[model samples]
Target: IRQTFPSAYFIELTVRQAHYAIESTERLPPAHLITWVLPDYIQFPFLGGGSNGFSIGVIPFAIIILALVLAPSRKLFSFLALYLIPLGFTLSIPPFSWINNYLPPFSHMRGNLRWMVSAAFPLACLAAASIETFIEKGIAGREKIMRRTARGVAVFVIVLVFVTLASQFLAPRLIGNEDFMGKLVDFHFRGRTATLPASHYLEVAESAVRDIGNQLSFANAWWVIAILMWVGAGGFFYFIARWRPTSKTVLMLIAGAMTVNVFAVFSYQYHNFIPQEIMLQTPALVNFLKDHEPNPRRYRIMGFLIGDGMFREVLVHSPMPPQELANMERELLVNNTSVFWEIQRMDGLEPYRTLRHNQLLNTLINADKAGYIFDRENPNVRALTLDRVDNRDALRSVTPQEKIKDFLLQLPLLSMMNVKYIYSLYPLQDPRLTPITIPRPASIPVNIYLYKNTQVLPRIYFAERPLFSKNQGTEFLLEIAEVNDFRHTTVIECNDCVARPVGRGQPPKFVINEYRDGLLSVNTETTADEWLVFSESAMPGWVATVDGVPAKIYTANYLFQAIQVPPGKHQIEWRYEDIFMQKQKALLEYLEKLFR
Candidate 1:
């Protein structure tokens, strides 16, 4: 595991724990993660207002709980222990969070809420076992009154589950009526007489009424079918209990019914499915980028599309039809769609990012917040909360506004990183960004404009002046933040390297012989020894060779790769050889040859 995921292990052992310590001072107590494992209605009385749509449902959870109390077994207890241990770490409640604070692996973890999912399997097993136990012990050999009570409880619980499911389906629509809207408005603005114009409220109420009416009209038939299924299941269970007290068929029927019931309720609530073509089709913006930029891998694009307040406004207030709204939502270039379109992007919702890259991003975000590069009143710029900006959560929480704002402040940094193009829902009012005129497709919503960065640097360049830093830390960031001309100067993190005076010199002529995943070859001709900086992430597992002789790769610009090259023509090659990947490839080849 350590060999396969060295970076992950390193982060868990060192970097992540340190970050958690810093965050612990200001972190709020997390929401109850256990609530997600319970029934959906327990979190939200109805359906639509809840944060998550998934749950274990009332019937299964209740059955499990009842079993644990009434007919506890060693195996069930072991499963319960398995369920609770992970759940406890995920809870992260105040003083108890010490479990996460001091524990090696848990302390290093973020998104601990996901641990609740591990509880589901054990809970399911416990529920199934409990039902069997109830049938055999509670009903088969029990007294008349005890058997009657068990049967009655089962019937009642079944009825309650169906009622909850029905409410989950119906309540959201029913509550969207004009009366509810008026009450909600009044409650929200009890003292304020003119928080919003009366016309706005009237319009909202009318929209709600129309939406609810349409939804309820279509859902009435589904609701009837669901209710009948529930009744039929209840009747079947009652008959089975009376006729055959200890039959395995009873358990199977109940399990199947519950599964179908849950799926049906979920399907009914979340029925707005988008067509496959609409979802996977490349957007006009993406197509234009691909057509224009042949070497997309050389440069990255920043997209200001996700979680933009302007986009949200359009979604809420645009006069577009429902189908158009759905189309717009699905077809928009968002999240990791750049991967699908084979376009390199500056930001994405990836699970993990290198700590150095995250630090660079955070520094840029902090520079924006300090109002050093961007005007405070610039609508094109906004600040990100630094506490939330880290390697684990930075890209996940990035919105269009924050990214554009970061770009405004970190133009030099972006250029150094080879960020050449930016697409935004709002016009970026910056001199460095020149708006690109492209024919907008019908599917691409209005106001999403793409711009070319006039100051973007090349993928590979030479710098005679090398600014040395002892480490890539606060001092290094401060040094680079003051560097206005990245083209003429480069920052290299080294204790022994000599710092040269910042001077202008003719850059070495370099031709990229080949650039592809895992390998890059460049031929360069220089009159004097100089630093060749590659605008790519500097990380381990990548080795550099000058004319097939091993060369040292230095951390440059706080986030990129740089190597010292002597005068004269040289063939420089870099190969990323992850040991884990090499081993896997060898194993696969061996297997294939063996099979043959």
Candidate 2:
């Protein structure tokens, strides 16, 4: 919003985005780092279409491919058969559950190593079918050519794997040199401090390793079972060669595993390949409502999937429009996105004061207490899907419009799939209801009433535009309180306030929540105009002088003060020693004292 809606005084931020900013901040003055950070173009190990996870899985398959090509013509079919057996077994295993667990919904891509593994057999089949046909024709020269080609491909695969592994290790140092790993670690850690030293990249690496070890150990256990099947099947093939076992026997064992493994790999990698996403979940509900099998498109329209029994039966029996059937996937994506945006909007309001409660608003004015409202359990929005909403439950449900008046409130980005739909259907006007035009191709407008007054009347506007455009017939009006001198009161010690994932107001600082004895004690509120500042004990001049009269100040390795009192209302502020945040227990100690 700061970048796009510059005229608006409001600013917005997210925890992840804030961390990213901090990561980038270390290298500042873009021109200095621009030429060094990125080159004109990168070449090698095409990451264009594949997920990072899928690329990892391609290593073993590439080796198998080469082995198949080099094997003698007489043994080629057996080698090929052995190569494919694991895939079929993989297909039989439901791997999608694991994959879904590995991948969070907001993940950028769906392709992974399992996908590569899934494709391996099909490619192998193509190669074998071609090679088998060639050998039957007795193309003697072609055999040598194929063998050499296979070896080359295998070499390429090995090289790709080595390079990929190297890049993972080299990336931190290469990108940011001495500070790279620290920055990456800091970015991931967000505002949280580690128990160990912040300078230790090894700790960061160890933590990451631990996390991956846990997840992959679970995932690869299945791979191990699959490999055991490979060993058994491979041994059977080896024995058949010696004992003159029937070709049909060898073929069935190899072919069955080959076919089954695809599903297994797909399931394991994709988390069951059953499409457990929210968009797909509505089908069960739709089928329940229809009482007969609904078409695939009907499930799509319904926005999620239902279970297999009643829902599946209903979908099977109901008359589904061929076009709607075709577009089921698209609709599911949109509905889910809408649901996520609503969650974010609701979550955003909790950290800020609502104008509806004068006491809370006054608390904000004095800085004595900051009010926050937890509307409900907010959905963990990883990525927004494609969806349009005629209304949002979060915005309209509030009694007073002023509660939703903050323009900088939560707005999430909608998925690209939904944006395309909204943009294509521009000027989507419905006169029967208060029509708020949805300009984007993929997202629908959340027509929300933000504020109300007797004279101003209620009005509506779009909560978020999924697909942004320069010429979207949009103009913004910013309302800054005209009264420059907002009244406030001061307190000797004030600590209560709302703290959350803020983007760009100020870097987070420690606070003290002063309370006395068994009963809670301390200032209830502080005026916006007053400063409740804390200082390190090291600050020789740092002392609390209420009305310029010296008072005995408590210091926990730092001095603290509440200053600049206008008298109506004010809260205590804690100012840290300049170097407090950079090192040691200074900041932590300050918070401990305040909260104590």
Against the hidden reference, what TM-scores do the models get? 0.73, 0.27
Model 2 lDDT on a 0 to 1 scale:
0.29
lDDT per residue as tens, model 1, 483-566: 877876788888898765555356578999898987889999887778888877777767899999999999898778999888
| Residue 538 Cα positional deviation in candidate 1, in Å, after optimal superposition | 0.9
| CA displacement after TM-score superposition, residue 587 of candidate 1 (Å) | 19
User: For this target, which candidate reaches the highest TM-score against the unseen true structure?
Assistant: 1
Model 2 residue runs over 4 Å out of place are 1-207, 215-220, 244-246, 266-596
In the range 1-596, model 2's lDDT, one tens digit per residue, is 32333211211211112122212222112222111111111111111222211221221233234444444454555545554443333232235433322333312122222333554455555445544443344332343443444455445445534544554565444444445546666765687544334544444444443333332232345534443443443343344334544445544654555455545555554642333353434332232323432321111111111111212322333434434432343332332332332211111122231121111112111111111221223352112210111101111122212222221121110110011111111122222113222222122111211111111100110111111112110010001111121111111221332222323232212223442211111232332222333321223223344434443443210112223333332233232322322223567788899999
lDDT of 1 at 137: 58
TM-score of 1: 0.73
lDDT of 1: 0.61
Q: Give the Å shift of residue 37 in candidate 2.
A: 34
